[model samples]
Target: MVFDFTISKQGNYAIISMNGNLIEKGQAIALLEKAEELTKEGCSQWIIDLEKLIYMNSSGLNTLIQLLTKARVAGGEAVLFNMNKKINELILITKLHTLFKVAGSKSEAVEILGL
Candidate 1:
């Protein structure tokens, strides 16, 4: 299962919609790179839509953490939305639910970001 991503800019935010499995190391690297690129482009606010993501391994989780960390370091926020049950469970088990900003829908995330 190849991981795919689409990035679009909306006002001051960068919205990334992800699909497929985000298990491969290369996929994680690619995702991190894209996030970094967005950061450099002055996109402080981000919305990562995971409604289409099928499966995500530990690496994928780490990738998200990295992105979130970067956003915080830049004095910004990264909001995740539409996470599947498995991903949500993993976040809860890892006690990372507190570290991430989660929203029920993309519109809600945008609202949270004040966009």
Candidate 2:
């Protein structure tokens, strides 16, 4: 299925809700880039809600890492929420699970952001 991204506020933090697939050279990057732009502008805390995501390729994983880097460099933080087991395994294989703060729920993530 095609992907759609929706961004909104969960208190003082930003939530990026993702649906569908995240693949190489796909709409996923567009969404990630948009989040990057926001981070570069100093929007620090992020919750990447992936409850509706069914697939995520390596490139998609890279996009997420890059976004986290950008956010951190900009003195912010990026947290992931509701990622499925398959995607979690991918992150583990890539060793990015250690680099990113992952939460089981959006509320948990938001609380981590101290929001």
Candidate 3:
């Protein structure tokens, strides 16, 4: 499937729902740009919903790390939720699970971000 994403606001956080395959940094440029815009708007906290993501490669992982860095630089945080089994395993294998805050649901992600 082709990569796509939607951005929405929830409280003080931005919810980024990703869909389809994510294997290239170019595909995430829009996402990163939107994140930067939101950060400037003082809505830096993020919840990345991966439930619809069909596949992800190393570049996808890098994109996530970039998001986390952006949030932190903005004095906020990013949480991930609704990850599929394969994605979860990839995170664990890469030891990124420790680098990221993950939740089982959107509500939980909001709680993690304290929003």
Candidate 4:
């Protein structure tokens, strides 16, 4: 599938449904920018739903870190849900699984934020 992403909301959380491949800086920047913009608009929770993300690269990891930083500085946090095994493995390999709050579903992620 062609690269695509859609944004949805659950209460105060912004859920990004990512698809296709994320291999370049532009993709990374776009995703990061959206999260940052939402944070500036007072979104207190961010959820990245990776159930559909087929592939990702280092830039995608960079984007995630950027959002995590912003979320923490804003007194909020980015949660991840429905991560594919491949994607999950990447986090583990990088030892970043500890940095993220992983949940089984959108509701679970929202609950983690106490929303």
Candidate 5:
């Protein structure tokens, strides 16, 4: 599937829902740009929903890292939720699980963000 994403807001958090294959950084430029815009608007805490994402490569990992960095630089945090088995394994394999806050559901992600 082609890569697509949606951004929404809940309280002070920005929720980013990703879908389809994420294999290239170029596909995520818009996402990063919008995240930057949201950060400037005071919505820094982020929840990345990956349940719809069917596949991802190293570039996808890079995108998540970028988002996490942006949130932290804004004095906020990012949590990932609803990841599939493949995606979850990739994160673990890369040791990125140690760098990211993960939750099993959106509510849990929000709780992790303390919102």
Candidate 6:
């Protein structure tokens, strides 16, 4: 399947739902562009819902790091929710799990970010 994303707003958070394999630079760039657009729209708090994502590569990891950095620069926070086991393992193996606030649900992610 082709990679794609959808963004929605919930209170102060921009919820990004991503799907398919995030292995290409173009896909990662698309996600970053969306986050940048949201940043310009005055949204700093973000929730990346990865429940539908089936594959991710190092580029995807970099995209997520860029998103988190952008949010921090905007004086907000970004958290992820519902990531699958393989993705979770990748994060942990890359030692990026410590950098992200992960949650089991949207509400839980919001609470973790205190947003």
Instruction: Please give the CA lDDT of all the candidate structures.
Output: 0.87, 0.82, 0.94, 0.82, 0.95, 0.89
By TM-score, is 1 or 5 better?
5
Q: What does candidate 3's lDDT look like per residue over 1-115, in tens digits?
A: 8899999997678899999999998999999999999999999889999999989999999999999999999999999999999999999999999999999999999989877
Task: Tell me the lDDT of candidate 1.
Answer: 0.87
In terms of lDDT, model 6 sits at 0.89
Candidate 4 worst ten-residue window by lDDT: 23-32
RMSD (CA, angstroms), candidate 3: 0.6
Q: In model 1, which runs have C-alpha deviations exceeding 4 angstroms?
A: none
TM-score of each: 0.93, 0.88, 0.98, 0.90, 0.98, 0.94
Query: Candidate order by lDDT, highest to lowest?
Result: 5, 3, 6, 1, 4, 2
* Candidate 3 clashing pairs, residues 3+ apart or interchain: none
The C-alpha stretches of model 6 lying farther than 4 A from their native spots are: none
Candidate 2: regions farther than 4 A off: none
Estimate, for each residue in 1-115, the C-alpha lDDT of model 1 and write its tens digit: 7899898998889888889998867787777888888888888799989999988988888888898998888879999999999988888898888989999998999999988
| Clashing pairs counted in every model | 0, 0, 0, 0, 0, 0
Question: Model 2, residue 74: displacement in angstroms?
Answer: 1.5
Question: Which parts of model 5 have CA positions greater than 4 angstroms off?
Answer: none
**Candidate 6: tens digits of C-alpha lDDT, residues 1-115:** 8889999988778898999988888777767887888889899899899999998999889888999999999888989888999999998899998999889998898888786
- lDDT (0-100) at residue 98 of candidate 4? 91
lDDT of 4: 0.82
**Which of the two candidates, 1 or 3, achieves a greater TM-score against the reference?**
3
